[model samples]
Target: MSTLANETYEARVVAASEPGVTFSGALSSEWIKFRTLRSSWAVLLAAVVALVAIAGLIGYVTGSKWDGQLDPEDRVASAPLQGLFLAQLLIGVLGVLFVSGEYTTGMIRSTLAAVPRRLPVLWAKGVVYGLVTLSTLIPTTFLAYGVAQLFLSHFGHSTSLSAPTAFRAVLATGIYLALVGLLGSALGWIVRSTPGGISLLVGLLLIVPVLLEVVPGQWAKDISHYLPSAAGASFYSSLQADGALSPGAGLLVLVIWVAVATTVAAFLLKRRDG
Candidate 1:
């Protein structure tokens, strides 16, 4: 072929390949990486099992002695979703590993090379992980609720899904967990160290809340409601606890936290060398 013909062919090829690193491509890449990780599957399975087991235990124990031992208020508020406390920790750790594992292994350099624009990688990771968490956990939450209610029904204490806020509460539990997973992913990207990311996540969700309790009176009450875990808890609570934000407000607060973390991660990702 002549030089002009060869050049024309090369230009067409380059143009065709230029779109390879697009947002959709990045999302697909991230999804593959996420699903291939053995640790990811293990953590997800563990979260589901723990959620179901804990809820079942609560149901069984409550139902066994419902007539005389259970309080009326407790029966009414019995969501058996305490398992989520454990699920959060497991899923959060999975999120930390999602990014930090790649960093620790030096895989991030290649990842950035493929998606030089940088921010798409962050967005892809956040969206993929969040969707995975939400899809898996939402159904699990419903199953757990069903199993728990089955046991509780023996004692005439089961609440219906049609009960006020019941369906919303179940749905919100999944949303809260998905947000938590994304928050953890952002922390992982920012810290780039497994231990560091996990520590920060734990402190934000658990330790900080405890530390705030040391503050006296209204100050603690005023501040604690905005913490990530507290805000998330409000979503699934049939009745908002005193000093806690309402469900809508709580969801907004948690979204802000996720957004802030993502923004910081994206900034650092662009500014720092991979």
Candidate 2:
């Protein structure tokens, strides 16, 4: 063939090799879609406001106490989780909606059509939710702590973030939110319906504890510690002080839950159709 013909052939091959975009680029596209959603912003703002309000109340009450025996460290450590239960619920729902909303609105078909490999879509949403959860949790936690400390100071019972346990508790709480969001995303993937997934999540968080309490064995309490919400909430040192679970133990349990949830979600995604 002539040199011109060879050059034309090479150009054609290059265009075919490029196809469209890389997997990472595809993932970025999903992230952009997720960030633009109104629910994402609303849930995140709710988490922050709730955290500050609840923690401020806890700190304010402790500051006004007449017992004169309350431990400031314990109060400070526990302050981060004051609104965690409520915040986690919102975060979980947001994570679920991130994926299930797509399914409900028939957007997942478009997503899958663009990226036939289904797992990447899940992975991208997981990454985006984790980032968004972490971003919201960090600032919300610190602001909550700051507000709490402000009220506590007026009563001469104050705390500082410079303390070792204070810092650890803050870090753990924020990380736990991200992990919980990811777990919710996984459950959302497995369930694929908004109401069903939310119901399952609420069951996991609330009903399990009630069931455990009704049972009649020490094993029940011990095993309940392994549940995601149970263990995750242990990040709140106030609750941990109640001997529910140690901080390290809580972290381990949460990691196991996330691992199991993610694995199951991946399997279901591959097996299920869009």
Candidate 3:
């Protein structure tokens, strides 16, 4: 046999031996694969930039409109959450792209080949994606908040992260981004089509829900609160709503969604032909 064939044979033998391999080892290999890819870093950086720019622009425009009637407190409370509506979209897209892009580029095949047990691969991807997104989101959000505060401070509407609501918003922003990323990755794994996964995510986040809201009924408003984006949005509210859930309830909604998606994805990954 040729030398290349001999090497391939040897590698296959070593992989087949696999007696000493552990979950941690598998996860580490997956992490290496994830971080070594250039697209991962690029997309993450782009998300941060997009979120910051959009938030800052909104701040600047609103600061310009601050006729000084709505006291600093009111202005700060009202405007800071504006950017999040768009920021979540960017984060959600990035999250979906993380998994779906692999399938689009035919990288999923190589990824699965390296780790023949597919579930571990998915789990590792979730861990890495979750941590990376959380890290980026926390800092990006605080930075956005600081930038917004700078604009607000100019108009005597400054806010600090130390405040109870501001602190919760900062933490919730990171947590919300992480959950969205997890949900996107799960859906991407199941759908395995970039456009399809993204469309599903966008539909859940913006499209189907918006149409439901426009129907002009109280039931729609009540049901809308249970949707992923709407439930997640509750965490950012400076003042808790009268009938709406507490922050913990909002987080529980996010958790349930992520759990359901991941479970379904896991089932599909194990049973379906890759």
Candidate 4:
């Protein structure tokens, strides 16, 4: 009886000594997985390069058009941001892979086995990758802005970052991309396939806008401005796009879009298999 009691106490101590699962641990795990993946870093680098490179190219062309003549008021609308459409494609796809790639490699089963509750894994992926996306994209956006303005400065056509519209356009562009990255991550949870998520993202951002333009109705015209792409664009530069919402309204619309996508994904995640 004494031996049995000693063994029981030993087993209890061992069990207590083992660490239990926690949300913070899950977050750390997801971060490690993200940083270790070559594709994640590669996509991030590609986004940085694409945005900065394209902005510089557009800036050079815009400046060169004036043949070295200065025009203080002839500035283009957010020329530094011209490259973000392409960056969106790259970053959005990476967000999709944040979830889908695990399933493809069968690692999700193990992840689920560890975090049986499941939704925390989904939330962690979005939060970690979203934060990573925001941190990287914001600085990169500013860098691209400076690079573009350098080219514009050569022709004395550069707009000041302190200018009211210029600050909003640049900062809003960064936030817009961060939300787009979240949108892509949410799509990954909903579809659970990288290709499918990518297709949906492209359809929503690129194809829908084109289709809306041809629908030939006031409703379509108004609704198009609320879609993720146009809404995000308006948040940065309502002055540039026709039928754009005010910056505040456009940002609100975009937040709704992202929130809805994530909620749908969460509902499906709770109901479906890993």
lDDT of all the models against the reference? 0.88, 0.80, 0.77, 0.86
Clashes of 4: 0
lDDT, candidate 1, 27-123, per-residue tens: 9999999999899999999999998888788887888888767665456543677789999999998998999999999999999988899899999
Off by over 4 Å in 4: 1-14, 67-74, 238-240
Model 1 CA lDDT for position 15: 53
lDDT of 2 at 219: 91
Best candidate, lDDT-wise?
1
TM-score versus the correct structure, for each prediction: 0.92, 0.88, 0.85, 0.91
Candidate 2 lDDT by residue in tens digits, 1-274: 6735646554555446566756687678877898788888988899888888988888788888825786654455656456888888888888888878988999888888887877787777888789878987988888888888888887877778886578777777778878878888888898999998888888888888889979998998878877887787676454453547787888888889888988999999888877
Full candidate order by TM-score, most accurate first: 1, 4, 2, 3
Tens digits of per-residue lDDT, candidate 3, 14-59, equal 4455565467876787678668878778767777776677667767
C-alpha RMSD in Å of predicted model 3 compared with the true structure: 3.6
Q: After superposition, which runs of candidate 1 have C-alpha atoms over 4 Å from their true positions?
A: 1-13, 17-19, 71-73
lDDT, model 3, position 25: 71
When 1 and 4 are scored with TM-score, the better candidate is 1
Candidate 4's displacement at residue 18, Å, is 3.1
The positional error of residue 178 in candidate 3, measured at the CA in angstroms, is 1.7
The worst-scoring run of ten residues by lDDT in candidate 1 lies at 9-18
Clashing pairs in 2: none
The whole-model C-alpha lDDT of candidate 1 against the native structure comes to 0.88
Task: Tell me the RMSD of model 1 versus the true structure.
Answer: 3.1
Query: Which should have the higher lDDT, number 2 or number 4?
Result: 4
lDDT tens digits by residue: candidate 4, 1-274: 7646546554455457678889998999999999999999999999999989988987887888865564543354565677898998988899888888987889989999999898898889888988898899989888898998899889887777887688888888888888998899899888888899999999999999999999997999988989999988888762656668888988999999989999999899889877
Identify the candidate with maximal TM-score: 1
Backbone clash pairs for candidate 3 read none
